[model samples]
Each structure stands twice: as C-alpha cells, then as structure tokens.
Target: MHGKFKGKHAIVTGGARSIGFEIARQFCAAGAMVSIFDYNQEALEIATTTLTNEGYRVNPFLVDVSDQLQVNLAVDRAEEIAPVDVLVNNAGICLVTPFLNIEAEEWQKTLDTNLSGAFYVAQRVCRYMARRGKGVVLNMSSKNGLDGEFGHAHYNSSKAGLILLTKTIALELAHLGIRANAVCPGYIRTAMNTEVDSDEFVEEFEDRYIPGGRVGKVTDIAPIFLFLASDDAEYINGQTFVLDGGQLAGQKPWKWLLEEIKL
Candidate 1:
C-alpha cells in the first residue's frame, strides 16, 4: 500500500480528467512514477500541475490514442523514464446517437479510439512487459458493453470489443506473466455526459434501476484498479469485474418498459 510501487512506473491513458485522472492520482499516491497520456493539451497541463503540487512525480504526454504512431512514441518515452509495471487502457470517446442515426465515420472513430486505441497501447506495453515476463494491463470497459442502451451503438460495440480483446491478451500472454483484465462500471458520475440532459434522469436511474439507490464515483472505481495492479490480485487475470452499485443484477425500472411497451 505504502510505497510498494516507489521505484516502479505506471501509465494511464486519457488521464487528464475524470476517472482516468483519479486513477492516475491514486497510482502516484502509491509511489509510482506515473505518466498521464491525454489528447487535451490544457488538461495535461492542469493534471500535471495538480499532481506535481501534491509532491508526486508525473509525466504528461499529449497523445491521441487513436494514432498508433503516437502510442508507440509515447510508450517509448514513458519507458525511458522507467519500465511500465502497470498500464490502464482508459483513453476513449463516447458520442451518443441512435443506431439509425450513426454514420460510418462516427462508428470508425469510436472503435479507433476505444477499441483500437486500447489495442495499440496494450500491445506496445505488453511487448515490453513480456520481455520482463510480467505486468498488469487494465482496460476501462463499461456496463453499456454488457447490455444495450437507448443510444450508443458505436460506443457499445467498442466497449464490447474491449472485453474480448482483454481475454485474448490474457490467454496469449499468460505464459509471459502479463495479466490482462477489464472493469465495467455502470452509471458512474463523471463529466463525460455533458451532451445529455440527465440531471433528473440520473436521479431516477439511481433510485430505480440501480439497486443500491446511488451512482458510483471515481473514488469507488480507482481503488479497484490499484488493487488489480497490485500483487494481491496476482492470481486474478483474464476476467471482467462489474462495479455498478448492483444495477446489473436488477431489472429495468417501469419507466423504461413504458417507453418501449415490450408487449
């Protein structure tokens, strides 16, 4: 818990804000010389300043994960600082739209960033970890990947692909001591939903669909990522964990059914 990762390094993609930022901070708190990779230049500056001010070491890389060349270069640079002992494939974009309203370009962009981007980083990092014969790779999947949503075919498909990608990585790299896994969080409160008018909806969603009657926080999710990255979970790999406040275990609220009239 304390300074176990002092000499090690961790990389967090899309780490400029929200869940990714929280995860990055926790890793730093654990004493890892962490690197934050994000496409937003301003966010990178702010995040870097925040962490460094806390007396934790962090290297920020302006990276668009959808680009393989950038992914390779960023990883290379991160490696120059220290070998990556843990990788959190958290960079992704979610643009909501009905399936019929989805364009080819939108679908491609989502996949490129969410699924393909994870591939690029995971493969590059795993290659390094493979040589060392050990490492942890954690992909940030979503509950949308598990079940269907009203609007988000492209986003759903990308996340769904990540679960399989994680499995494949685990199976292929098991002999190499590189563990891969995914976390599916449901209805977590974050700034990613600005496009949607969901203040009232979220309250209802929590009270109804989510059995726990509350939404999740980054604090609720960040600790798990650190756990998976640690030796305690050395025996756990190639699996997906759902942190949804019991939402996945329950059924939809009456409002959802009323909207569709399944019968």
Candidate 2:
C-alpha cells in the first residue's frame, strides 16, 4: 500500500498466474507501472483486465520467455512506455520424472525455460538498466535447487544453475548499479502444484515438511520480491532470501538419532 515503488516501471515474467501474478500485483499496488509478460494469452488478458480495472497500471504481453527474440522485442516495447526499473525473472517450467526416465528434450525444455530463460531476459533487461545505470533483477529459484527432490532432477538442476547465475550477474553488474538476487520458495500453494488442493498432499506437506504448519500462499512471497525490487534492499545483493518456514533446516527424525547413538 505504501508507494515504495512509485514512478518506477517493472516487468514480471510468467505473470499470468501463481507467484509471478502475485509479484506483478504487488508492484502495481506499490505504485509501479507493472508489465505482465507470459506465454498464456488467456491468463494474460484476464490478469491485465483485473489489475487495470483496479486502477493499477498494467499491460500484458504474450511472449515465451525462452525465446530471446521475443524477450528483446517485449522489453523494447515496454521501454517505449517507460524505462524498466525492475526485472523479475519469474518464468519457469517443471517436469517430474525419474532421472532414469527423463528424456533429453524434456531436460532441455526445463533448462531452456527455467535457467536459460532467465539469462535471456536478464541480458535484455540489463541493456536497458545499463543505459540508466540503475535497476534490480530478481530471479525465482526453489528449495528443490538446494535440496534435491525425487522425480525432479531436471527441475532441480535448472533452478540450481539459476541461483549461481544470479550470483554471477550480481557480482558482474554491481558496477553498473544493478542489483541481482534470488528467492527460494518451498511448498507454495500455486496452480502448478495441484497437489496443494488435494487433502492428501496438504496433509503430507504440512505434517512432514513445513514447520510453519501450513503451505505458503502467493501473498506470502509478493512482499519479499517487492522489497528486493525497491531501493530498500540496496545493500542486499548476490544473496538468496529463503521463504520456506525453515524447511531447509532439515527434518527431525528418529533414525538419525540411532546413527548418532552408534557414533
């Protein structure tokens, strides 16, 4: 509600739904001109309409993040309206398959969307930021990147690479006054995770994984991104903000105690 990002321009990749949509909404609410860039035309239109109707500055563009040409053109179009002040590399894909069963194309697809896509958008946006000598880039990584997830080797690898990419870019671009960082979210309630809607997964996710006793909502994450995008985090760079309710702290179990006893 505070005009933290007032008079700024931001682009949110994968802004159609879930985490990306929430980031876009927060940017708009905080007095930023938000651009929704996604591949889903229907969701793009719907999101644009809703946000614009709410008296927020919103513009939707249908583009595949993995395509460099599309990304460059979209940034160009967005710049025509206003120079982009923040870039959220939120577009990503997930494929759950056993490591042995994973196909080359499937791995490539996930990598292209999750890791390479961030590179493409970042490279493009950095051009604009370089000219202005100021901007922020926020990459979306996941807890799976830190701790491997079964049936998600490709996704894990892609996100892991993305985090390193974030760090490298941060170090390299600091001289240009561009800040880069990542957000790793664990067990967020999103459309992609239909299991969150099921009673089965909800019970499992809460009882075993998240110590917070509940899954994260989109609203839970938007503020963090907004903070990173704003000048408030000017000193925070090349770091990852983990919002997993201490999931990475490791799970408590009895078997480990027996091993410790033997030791």
Candidate 3:
C-alpha cells in the first residue's frame, strides 16, 4: 500500500481540487514525485503549497488542458522536474443544458474541454511513455458516458467520446507498454456536484439512487487510480471501471412487486 510508486513521476491534470487533488495526493503518498497541472492559478498554488508543507514532493503548473500549446508547455516543465511514468487526464468541464436549448458555442466549449483536452494531454504524455516503452494513462470519464442523463447532452457526448478515445489509445499504445484506462464515477461529493444540488436534494438523491446508501467520496476513487497506475494492474488495459455504488445495475422489478404486495 505504501511506496508502490516510489521513484516514479506522475502528472495529474486538474489536480488543484476535489477528486483530482486527492489522486495527486495519493500518488505523492505512494512516493511518486507529483506535478499538478490546473487552469486555476490560486488553487494550484494552494494545493502545491499544502502538499509540499506536508513533506510531499509536488510541483504545480498553470495550464489549460483545452489549449494544446499550454499542455505541451506544461509537459515540458513537468519532464524537466522528472520523467512522467503516470499521466492522469482528470481535467474536464460539464455544462448541463437541455438538447433543444444548447447553443453551438456551449456544445463546442464542452467538447473542446472534456474530449479534446484529454486527447491533447494524453497524446503529448504518451509520446514520452512510448519513447520510454512503459507508462500508465488514466482518464477520468463519467457514469453518464454509459447511460444518458437528462439535460446533459454536451457532457454525455464528451464523456462517451472519451471512452472511445481511451480504447483507441490503449489498443495503439499497448504495443509500446503504455496502458490506458478510464474511471467512470457517479455522484461523487465534489464541488461540481454540490454547487448545483442542494443539501436536501443530495440526501434524497443518495437514498433513492445509490444502492450503497450514500454517494461516493474522493477517497473512494483515488486508490483505484493508484492501483491502475501501479505495476499490479499491468495487465488491465482499455477498461472502464465504473465506481457508482451499483447505481447502473438497473431497477429491481421483483422488489417493486414485493412492495406492491405489501401495499
């Protein structure tokens, strides 16, 4: 559990906060030198400072993943610090809008950030992995990628595209010893979710939808990223691991019938 990544280098996109931040922290705790890339300068500084203060190796870079030039530059800076052995493409954006009301600009922005950004970051980092003949790429997908959600046309489309993108990367890079995988999380207690949903709604939704009786947390996800990036998961490739507390397992009609009988 400890030092599984000792002496390795990891680059985590969107690592300034939430799930991304937790992943970066876990990697550092496992003894990997970590570089956090984020668009938010203030958050990046704070996270980097906090991790460093905790006696962890951490470097922060301000880069927008949607911009290829910025991603390239950030990779260069990260490589200067250490050769990247693990790349976590965790940066993305979601815009919830009805399909009929979604504007062209909004759709473009969502895809550009969620899909194209992951592509740019992965391609740039995988090139180095290819040269080294070994690396791991973990993409942050969403449960919405597998099932449609209301008022999330753009978000769902981008995540669906990312799943395919992950597969393509895995197939192409497996020959080079670079494994690619995706983690599809549902109802995580992140700022993105809390910002939109009220406390009452969160409590009700968890009770109704999550079979595990609660929504997931950042800790629930970070370890999986570490496992996939570590040597233990060398054979795991081109797979999307859904961590949703069985939310996608479908409703139980038999259970409904039992309830009806009781009524």
Using TM-score as the measure, the top candidate is 3
**lDDT of candidate 1 at residue 75, scale 0 to 100:** 97
* Candidate 3 residue lDDT tens string, 4-64: 8899999999999999999999999999999998999999999999999989999889999
lDDT of 1 by residue, 1-263 (tens): 77867888999999999999999999999999999999999999999999999999999999999999999999999988889999999988889889999999999999999999999999999999999999999999999889868779999999999999999999999999999999999887887874574789888777778878899998999998999999999999899999999988967557666678655
The 10-residue segment of model 1 with minimum total lDDT is 250-259
Q: lDDT per prediction?
A: 0.92, 0.90, 0.91
Candidate 3 whole-model C-alpha lDDT, 0 to 1: 0.91
Query: Which 10-residue span in candidate 3 carries the lowest summed lDDT?
Result: 250-259
lDDT of 3 at 17: 95
- Lowest lDDT sum, 10 consecutive residues, model 2, at 254-263
Q: Which regions of candidate 3 deviate over 4 angstroms?
A: 252-263
Best by lDDT: 1
Alpha-carbon RMSD to native, per candidate: 4.4, 3.6, 2.2
Identify the runs in model 1 with alpha carbons over 4 angstroms from their true place. 252-263
Q: How close is every model to the real structure, measured as TM-score?
A: 0.94, 0.94, 0.95
Model 3 residue 51 distance off true place after TM-score fit, in angstroms: 0.4
